[model samples]
Target: MKDPVDILSALADPTRLGAIRLLWDGEEHCVCELMRKLGASQSRMSRHMATLKVAGLVIDRRDAQWVRYRRNPALSPAVAAVVDAALALPVTEKAEEIAA
Candidate 1:
């Protein structure tokens, strides 16, 4: 598990939170797919993903021209619980407000 502060900080952003919600299903998602769903530019989406990666909340793999992302499966039990709790929370309108 990463520093609790770092993990929590990563989830503070609406964009990253949106990405996490999309990934909560445990399915691999291409960057392009996330970009389309979130209405974010490629660079912005990638940058936010980098933050999530640094926080150890997500892992990625290069796939030819695109990168696929998924929630980190190896999170410590405590961290996993935190993430699960966050995901379980009902979505608010503010959380769905991803900037263009």
Candidate 2:
């Protein structure tokens, strides 16, 4: 069985971290918004998202052509705590630039 710590480590990447941070603020976000906020290529963002999904850190729903993602509230208390902590941090300058 895969270690839960290893799953968390997968989400530790800067880019994936940023993506999770962005989703932390709101209920959900479309792929384009994530790509824009992270300034990542579609493929790159997709890969990171896939990692998060595999880690059970994120959940996704499709809206037409867009796939929206959000933190998995159903996660264990420990994981939810980590996600809450990440959301508390101020948005980074890079994230702002991408938001703009």
Candidate 3:
């Protein structure tokens, strides 16, 4: 698992946090899907997913020209708990506005 601080910091950004939320269901999401849902550009979404990967919060694989990502399935119980807690936090009004 990544350092607690790194995991927390990785999730501090709204984009990354939103990615995590989307992956929380344990479904692999392609970069295009993430971009469409998050309303981010390809480069920007890739950058955010890279950050999550570095934090050990997500894993990715190439699918033709696109990359797919999902939550790390091998997370330690403690790490999973932390992620659950973070996901439990309510979305902020600003984030809601962005989604709208």
Scored by TM-score, the top model is 3
**Looking at candidate 2, what is the lDDT of residue 20?**
80
lDDT of 1 by residue, 46-78 (tens): 999999999999999999999999999898889
lDDT of 3 at 26: 95
Of 2 and 3, the candidate ahead on lDDT is: 3
What's the alpha carbon RMSD for model 1? 1.8
| Number of backbone collisions per candidate | 0, 0, 0
For each candidate in turn, the TM-score is 0.92, 0.77, 0.95
TM-score of 1: 0.92
lDDT by residue (5-98, candidate 2, tens digit) is: 8566865577888788777764899989889777888888898898888888889999998899998777777777766776567777754665
Q: What C-alpha lDDT does candidate 3 achieve relative to the native structure?
A: 0.89
Instruction: Give one digit per residue, the lDDT tens place, for model 3 in 1-100.
Output: 5799989998888888888989999999999999988889999999999999999989999999999999899999898898899889999986665455
